[model samples]
Every structure is written in structure tokens, then in C-alpha cells.
Target: MGGSGLLGLEVTRQARRAGQRVATTFHTRRPDGDAHHLDIRDRAAVIALVRAVEPAVVVNAAYLQADWATTADGGTHVALAAAATGARLVHVSSDAVFSGAAGRYDETAVPDPITPYGAAKAAAETAVKAITPAAVIARTSLIIGRGDSQHERQVHALAGGAPGALFTDDLRCPVDVGDLAAALLELASSPHAGVHHVAGAGAVSRHELGVLIARRDGLDESALPRALRAGSGLPGPADVRLDNTKTQALLTTRLRGAREFLASPLPVE
Candidate 1:
């Protein structure tokens, strides 16, 4: 639903390019062009919007890391609305659902969240599954954009003498935003149901990812500071990698790794 965010914006752009009649939802900041202002926290509003749109498929990309009502309860509200309208649902999820205890997770791995955000995401996944059994609960890891993603921005800021250091021990499989959006769209139109792991091909530490980003953007990679997340008392997972081998087999779209995608500079706008 979040048509203004990076991944959501890419999804909307790709869908429009494919000649699909898309209706997007926004929360605080409205997206450019036409969009429905939807506060998914309100169940009745969610239902009303879904009914009004009468969409053939619904891709809910809206979420808040800190708000339980929005991430968990809001997801349920969306699911209930989508189920009632019989719309094919592709609910975007996060790898934060995992505790990183298992190191790697497939579609079958049960969520063991240690943080509030992770717990909320897990709860959302559970509710979406129970409400809409046919819905695709696509769980993903760190989403990396060419130059506009938060990670990229942080790297830029750090290189420019920002205080924070990218964690060297905090590992993730960062997927390209374009590839992830394409995969989500593919699953929306496909017959796949249940949980799916849609992530990049390889795993890299957050620091390494930042270095790649630095190089891609012509920054001094050494200028980016690094630290271990283990002793830093970060309340999140350390090495959660989504096993996308199974999901990759089912889709034609190739999910490129960060090393591959960030190897060369993107064309300047």
C-alpha cells in the first residue's frame, strides 16, 4: 500500500509500466499523482478503501517499525479487507521476524523475534496466513536502492563525517529494490501461495554493504567507520539471511546480490 516509500514507489512504477491500473495508499506524506489516503490502523477505513478500489490484486507494502497497531494490527485489518473483497493479496513482510539464531531461514522457518518490531512482524505474518490462506506472505531482508535508500544515505552521511558507524558484524542479504519489486509483482500474478523468501543471492555485513555503496557512489570507502554489533547491544538480529533458493526457482526474475549490483556506479540523473 505504501506508494511513497522506496520499494513501494518502485513497485508502483513497475506496475504502471506493465499497463496495470494501480491504486496506491499513503499514510502521512501523500505520494505524487493520484493516491488514496488510507490509515490502515482503522479497520473500517481499510475495508472501505478496498471495497471502493475493488482491485484484482492487493500489494500491502505499508509498515511501521515502532508502531504495533500499524505493523501487526494494521496488517490484520488489510488482510481482513482483502479477504472480504476476494482480492489476491501479496503482503510484504520482513526478516526481522527471525531472531538470527538459526543464521539462515527458509520459507518454513518459524519466527522467533526478540525485538518488538520483529514480534509485530511475526504477528502480522500469522494473522495474514490465518485470515487469507491463499495470500503470499513475502518475507524479505534489507532492501537496497541504487542511491536513494536509507542505507545509501547513511553511508553518504558517514563518509561526510557523521558519528555513527556501520556495524561490521550485523549481516544481511540486501536485495536490490528493483529486483525485489519485480519479484513481488511476479508472485502477485503467479499461483504461488503461503510464505516465500524473497531476498538477494548472497549475504554481506552491514559495514561491507556500506563499503560497496561508498565505492559505487565514488566515496572514500575507508572513510566509513565500522564497529561490531555483537557488543554494541543492538536489540536486533546479527546474521539473518533469507534462503531464496526455493523462491528463485519459481520466478524468472533474478535477485542480484549487493556485491553484484553495487559493483559499478549507477548513471547519474
Candidate 2:
């Protein structure tokens, strides 16, 4: 999977801390830790790796950068391989499965993806389900945490006083990367199967998220640009906040919101 990405890297760390022997796969970028080279698009590569690893649980955190071959088709390949091995599979997915036209989407909600990324993810989920009914499809939201590119961009925007609408009208349930990683690991061992909304308990507008991040970082909130997604005539759906109650009930983990997570003291390095 995408062990180089934010979630994958963190999942690797968390899984290790929990005393589980871990093995991760990376794409082109050389990962910071030991990892196997894998292009999920290559079905043979995926199967061979799975068989060699023979992991009790397979976590597919790998994704592509706007490429369908890996993003859309990759999950299917992993699911198929994991199915053949009879290993529990946890596939990381996105809330993009829901078109912003509607919000508070639940596990049972039919996917109406408005973006190509969403479509690809939805397609991957379908294929995974068909291939492995016992797999756990974790559809999460904006993953915000330290070292995350999006979080860094927001911080840089506030520090540089970047002009224009620091505005984001689309609503999302931004989840802490650590909390999400924990939830994914929990689901790996749980009996739950099918799609689950693994997101923060709080739902806020993108603009609000920026403000919260700015405030948390002690940046000039007044300088944060404010724009409306609808006002800007953005061509995509808005408000794809998810209902995480199902996941919450299933696991003891708590996925705190941006405001809540930000309010906590930055860890002393």
C-alpha cells in the first residue's frame, strides 16, 4: 500500500507500537523505513507480495496521485490477493465516495461520487466488496495532523498571509491521522465487515477548519483569507460530512475533531 503517505506511515508506526510485526509496501518514493516495492496496479506483484508476507491482516493504505490504475484498480488487486490468502484486509478509503450535494453520509448510504477521485474510490470499494465480503473498507475524511501536507499548506497560508479566499465552503469531517490509524488497526482485528465511516465526530466547513488550524498554531486568524465554496462557484459537490457513530460504537477509539485536536498541546519533540 501507500506506506509513504501520511496514513500509511502513521499506520506503520502505530501498528508497531501496538506490538504487531508490520510489513509495508511503497511505490516510487523510497520510504523512511523498510518496505517492499509494490505497484498495486500489477496484480501479479500484489499477489506475490501477499503470499510471501502471509500476513494475518492486510492493510491497503496505498493510493495513487490522481491515477486510476493504482487509485481505482489497486484496492481490487489487494482485496483479491488478501482474499486468496484468507487474511483480514483493511482498505483505506475516502469520504469522496459521497458527492457533497449531501452530507452526514452513513455506511449504508449509496455512493454518489462527484469527483474523479471519488468515482475511482467508489469503484475500488465495489470491486473489493465483490472480491472479499469480509474485508473492512474504511472510508475516512480529510486526514489532518502534524507533517500532513494539507495541514502544512494551511499553516503556510496563514503565516504568509496568502491573499484570496483562505476560504473553503465545502464541509468535511476532518479526522486526526493518529486517531484514524488507531481505528484502522482496531478494525483489522474486529469482526466488522463492509464500508465504515471512520471520521471525526465534529463536522465543520473548510473555512472553519482553516480558522481552527490558524488559531491552534497561534497564527493571525484575522489574516486568514475567507472565501465561500458556493460563493466561488466551485464545480463540485459540497458538505460531505460523515456519520462516524457506527465506527465509534464498533471500536473504543475516539477520533477527535480539528478544533479539539488542535486545542491540545503540541507534542514536545
Top lDDT prediction, candidate number? 1
Model 2 clashing residue pairs (backbone) = 1-62, 2-62, 166-225, 167-227
Q: Per-prediction TM-score, please?
A: 0.98, 0.95
- Computed on alpha carbons, the lDDT of every model, listed in order, comes to 0.93, 0.83
lDDT of 2 by residue, 154-193 (tens): 6557667665565566788988899999999999988999
Evaluate model 1: give its TM-score.
Answer: 0.98
Question: Candidate 1: where is the Cα deviation over 4 Å?
Answer: none
Worst 10 residues of 2 by lDDT: 147-156
Q: Across residues 1-269, which tens digit of lDDT does each residue of candidate 1 receive?
A: 88888988999999999999888999888887669998989999999999998999999999999899999999999999999999999999999999999998999999999999999999999999999999999999999887889999999999999999999888899999999999999999999999999999999999999999988888999999989998887698898999999999999999999999899779777
